[model samples]
Target: MNQYSTHDTSGAQLKLWDSAGPFETGAMQQLRNVASLPFVFRHVAGMPDVHWGKGATVGSVIATKAAIVPAAVGVDIGCGMMAVRTSLTADQLPDSLSAIRAEIERAVPKGMESSQTANHVKGGWAITPNSVGRAWNDRFEARWRAILARHPKVDGKTSDQLGSMGGGNHFIEVCLDEEDRLWVMLHSGSRGTGNRIGTYFIDAAKEAIAKERLDFHLADKDLAFLSEGSQLFDDYIEAMHFAQDYAVANRELMMGRVLEALRKHLPAFKTDKQAINCHHNYATRERHFGEQVWVTRKGAVSARAGELGIIPGSMGTGSFIVEGLGNEQSFCSCSHGAGRVMSRGEAKRRITLEQHAEAMKGIEARVDEGVLDESPAAYKDIGAVMDAQQDLVVIRHRLRQIINIKG
Candidate 1:
């Protein structure tokens, strides 16, 4: 068939494009939760990488009309992918990839620890922050000031957390495209700022319905929604917009640092082709299904016809540059990556370092114990994931990793 079809149910219609396989009970539960939303537009679209996430499925798309699910956007808020094509070819990279990784790790803070001088954990703002955070502070703080003026609880966090990559699936990689052109790709989000906004709004939405006769199961508390006309809803949109901007800026700033780190090894580097930064975890008002609706793409990317997007593979596998097909049934979306087959704890417990090293045989990256949870074996096969969404996206480029940096 030209395009894989979606599953339609009594309450909602859903298009599941999984070249990968059928969903597990956990994933199915999350999908059902999303489908249960009253305002969900048409059917929910589940990408090949569909997996169980905090409140919703990780690789699913939830398009809604009047109300928006803040949990569907999740706490990471603006989590997405960013990649840059550099002028330096594969030949320019040094045989020893350790220094390149070190440079990148040093350039950007990649852990849970604060690199800042002070703490601003109260509300959401950080205390003493880094240059990247400082640059974003003034703008975000102004917006936060306005938000807090109304809801004093919406405290601002430091931007020092902005450029820092968080733990778990988040990563940075130096890859080579099909033609052997070098590219750098990474995944991150709004950090502390987005988390604060998301948490605050989600709590407000839940409390807003505290006394209402809400169906517990039929009413997903996590799917706690904020209607467009409400004050909290407006604040959410504002904070969400700010977080999205922070996420994009975070990726840009980190990418710039990555380029600078690369220059230490290959001085003639210039980023040009294959450079893209996009948000997969945010909401936007758009005309879809013949009406103006707020599209909340939690783990899905905007796959409008012919749009360029990154579909990354596991640490040891190949990623893709895809052209969106704009499949209306899927809300014009596609998978983010090869979804996890198991949780991080499970992967760490089941996969071994030797297996990880074996899977990543050709790639120049860390095979240490800390990354065992990120082993290729821990994820669904990328090839299968791509095959599932044949109707959603067309592969434009196949990328293989050379050097990978993890946080």
Candidate 2:
């Protein structure tokens, strides 16, 4: 059975779903802060992957009546996972995947620091606003323009940031499922444009609160929020929606590029019948507990009945494709992945090159000191993370990486 701890305040009641053994103190503190908020609709739901994050815990589901926290959505707006089944099997792959990895590096712009950011940039935009961005921008440009007009501070360069990969923990991989079928997977978010948009709005929210001289126990400056019906709130919503679209397109564009890379080395292959891309860090309006509210899922994947989602493992571990169980108590959500057990800085300091190389021996991925922080040891056991939420999502596929490109 799922276990929880609850807290009550005059403003709201909060519930945190966590296993007794693995919950972190930092996560609990963030939960406490959210519970103290005045407009919180119901209890805060924490998933097994719970960890400390900027405004809210990473693996939390927070519902609010009429206000939205910009930082809670995070700088990587619409950050999520994407995976596609392929016709290729493990047996079809070459003995050494180095060629495949190099081909992918050539096809997709993987590492931004090494690649010419200048080529990827246009008019001070970070992502180059490729065809994908242009199409999506055109569809929402009218709304975007209107919002920016009202809030003139809402920079318009975010559109050019689409289709780019952001740094840290974001990655692209080629994997083989338990049954040996190939799967291409990646994780990224709205790039420079998204960061600028998020930062600008977060400051605006804080300024709005400061202007009113409101009094409240804010856990972190990142918790500053825009109240519903306010002009700033409207602008954030519109801007965030556009960022979400950009994020989705960003992954799609990367996936296309990765596939092209595979074609360069592997035999002619086709994508399988199924593919899934899901956002785990964003908010949307949903009906729950007989009321309509904005549900913010931070490092939590929606687990509504029959919903398909991706739960990635750390580098050198197994990843899963899952179907939601629609457990209402969890806000119909599941953990995004095996949560980090240590900060990247700490992980890099704690783990050794020998350990990382050994763990990644069979995989075609980078093993240099640069990627030590993302070593599998830095994250919770994927098996344990999945076992903790058997009731939340049903496993559809268990995948192991063969080739991984960390960004």
Candidate 3:
């Protein structure tokens, strides 16, 4: 039996798994807009955690033939999750989680007002650790310099930012899986350099559309796309791949930072088990339904059968490590995390500091008004989200966050 409900729009179709949580009118309309696009392949797939986003709805999986939409991919080019199961167990952790949180915040730069901010973190790894330098020199630096050769504006101090975590939904946490094993899980992306690439390409596509006067009756100008063979399209795909690689390396660098911090407080441990690093907000070429096409997962994760992905809950809740079932209909994808139920502004206005604090009473995380926007109440019920996508993935490890560090 099919696990999705089909919504027929003016063009193509939308297969949504709405049993976990219902989407708002705007979110549904966004999917319909993509469906109406001329290059969209087959149909659109909306995950259970579907919600509204900047250009396209979050939790959307779009497959296109001969064209790619940069806006659909969003700004956090390679944003995703990375997790590692440490040798330590829950009982081995310190009685107070605050020390761990403090050490992590100290080791990693985070919560900047914007990527351009000069004073985001006090005394950030100013000297650039020898290890981080080695990691970048090994692979990242050369790729970035090549991208800079073509697009100067996309360049940034990648050396300083490579291992850093940016603000918003990005975070680092120490969690305990169902088996009581300790784990280090973090969320980040390609950082500032990726942001510039994503923004540059998204606008470049729209600007090209405006310059050449090519309009396929686009409902929203942000839906602009570049044809597969176009020069701009080639440039974007190359740049995007660079950012994706940077993001992977970025997470690896941060995981190293976290492990170093933990080593100071606890017994020496190894993070060689159950390691997973997957990208949720990126696009790539994949074959589905007998045709090769570009697949963009906005707020989704690739869940090819047996492949592992991480789906995290809110600050107070927990997370999941799942192995994909490779559901072809959904293009082998699933939700990235608990989709936000309210916007940041709305969350700040509606949720009180007291309510946020109460919600995260046990978790070692920020409860100040500054972080009220990330309150658990601001997001959908994660349990319902998992239940809704049962056919897409099977839960491997359910991890409850014991130490949450927000950036």
State which candidate has the highest lDDT.
Answer: 3
Model 2: lDDT equals 0.81
Per-residue lDDT tens digits of candidate 3, residues 123-144?
A: 2345677778898899877877
Candidate with the greatest TM-score versus the true structure: 3
> What is each predicted model's overall lDDT from 0 to 1?
0.79, 0.81, 0.87
Determine the C-alpha RMSD for candidate 2 after optimal superposition of all C-alphas.
2.9
**Alpha-carbon RMSD, each predicted model:** 3.1, 2.9, 2.3
Q: Identify the superior model by TM-score, candidate 2 or candidate 3.
A: 3
Model 2 Cα displacement at 341 (Å)?
0.9
Number of clashes found in candidate 2: 1
Per-candidate TM-score against the hidden true structure: 0.92, 0.92, 0.95
Across residues 260-313, which tens digit of lDDT does each residue of candidate 1 receive?
888888858667855688888988988887888888887889999979998888
1 or 2, greater by lDDT:
2
Runs with alpha carbons beyond 4 Å of true place in candidate 1: 7-12, 114-134, 214-217
Candidate 2: list runs displaced more than 4 Å: 3-12, 19-22, 116-147, 151-160, 213-216
